[model samples]
Target: MLSDIRPAIVSTILFTVLLGLVYPLAITGVAKLAFPYQAEGSLVRDSAGHVVGSALLAQPFAKDEYLHPRPSAAGNGYDPTSSGGSNYGPLSADLAKRIKGDAAALRQSTGHVQIPDDAITTSASGLDPDISPQYALLQVDRIAKARGAAADEVRALIQRNIQSPLFGFIGQPRVNVLMTNRALDLALPKGQPKRA
Candidate 1:
């Protein structure tokens, strides 16, 4: 029994040191070396070089002039630490009530009777940074009106920011809302302040 126990203890310690310590350290080192920007949380910066946000996370943009991300259930919107959806299943009265409310708001703002589901629903992660291209285009007119810019110019801005499917077909075409808003701010006429 003593001999068998000794081998088991040795193996346990060996694996603990190898997998619990060495493996994580080695992988972290490789990641830090290979993708320094991403290793630091993929933060985005403003033109003046101040850190604005992480490209990987979504932010709440409530202004009409800025495009919005899908509804978020994480701590009043975009709290990475509490990332999760409402968890309300289909046919749930609570879910229906929330969607009905959001759809009403979107219809009023976008002036469209039929808005896309994504426009009113939160993503499962509750922090998706991308919106479908269709949804982004749906807001072009509203944003243009809010900013007093021409709809065609705003459409052109959206077109310029459209990110193609990864490697030509991995995911649907989507727009990163924060990136698009930043571009709009930069292109806005002189003296216009960047919206928070």
Candidate 2:
């Protein structure tokens, strides 16, 4: 019985060291070496060299001059600590009401253009920094008008920022709103504030 129990305990310790500590450390080392940028959270920087945000997480951009990301149900909107969907089911009256309010606000802000569904819906993570191309296009006019730039120029900026689908077919094309907006800020002349 003593011999049996000793071997069992020894094996348990060996497996724990192998699987619990060594495996995790090995994988982490490999990931850090192979994908340093992503392993470090994919942070984005502004022109001033200040870290602004992470590409993996979304932040609120309510001002009309910037393209808006998905509606966040996360705490205080885009709080990474609370990243999650609203959890309201498709048939939930609360969900319908929230969508209605969001749609109404969007229509009022963007002047009755055919709003994309993504424009009004919250993403599953509530921190998706990317929005559909259609949604990005929908906001171009508003952003251009607010920034005092020509619509064509703003459209071009959006076009430039449109990220292709993974391997050209896995997911739909999307625009990283933060990157596009930062590009807009760089493209426009200094001291210009968004009008509406």
Candidate 3:
């Protein structure tokens, strides 16, 4: 009985220290050294050298001068702690109603006959940082008007920020809303004030 108990306790202590402590620390150290930016949450900063947000997660941008992320259903929108979809199926009337309302509002705002799907729908994670290039382009005129910049200038900014697909074939082209908005602030800082 004593012999068995001694081995069990030794095994428990050894495994606990090795797996619970050492393993996590080792992996974290490696990650930090290899991917420092990502390990630090990919935080984005402004020209003033202040931390604004993360490049990986989505954030709400309600101002007309800024580019907006997708419709988030995560804890009132873009809540990283509660990242998830609304789980509304295609047949869900509530989802349909929301989409219709959003579409109508978008139509009124942009006046584009063909609205992009991403502009109206929420992403699966509800924290998608990227938006389709078309959706970004759609909001160019409104953003330009709000920022007191020319429409072509705003459109060019979006074009510069548009990221190509993974390996040129895997994924769709997307624009990081946060990055583009940051660029907007830098390019047209005259009329648009810095967000607190």
Q: Tell me the tens digit of each residue's lDDT in model 1 across 1-196.
A: 8779988999999999999999999989999999989998998987787888988899999988889999999877889989999998889899999999999989889987878778889998888999988899999988998888999999999988899988998988889998889888878542566543
Candidate lDDT scores, in order, read 0.88, 0.86, 0.90
Q: How do all the candidates rank in terms of TM-score, highest first?
A: 1, 3, 2
**Candidate 3 on 128-156: residue-level lDDT in tens?**
99999999999999998887889999999
* Model 1 spans with C-alpha error above 4 angstroms: none
lDDT of 2 by residue, 1-196 (tens): 7779988999999999999999999989999999988988898876666778987788989887888899998887899999889989889999999989999999998886588989889888889989999899888788888878899999988999999989999998999987787788878743654321
RMSD of each: 2.0, 3.1, 2.6
Estimate candidate 1's alpha-carbon lDDT, on a 0 to 1 scale: 0.88
Worst 10 residues of 3 by lDDT: 187-196
Model 3 lDDT, residue 181, Cα: 86
Q: Which numbered prediction scores highest in TM-score against the true structure?
A: 1
In model 2, which residue pairs have backbone atoms overlapping below 3 Å? none
In the predicted model 3, the residue pairs found to clash are: none
Q: Provide the global lDDT of candidate 3 against the true structure.
A: 0.90
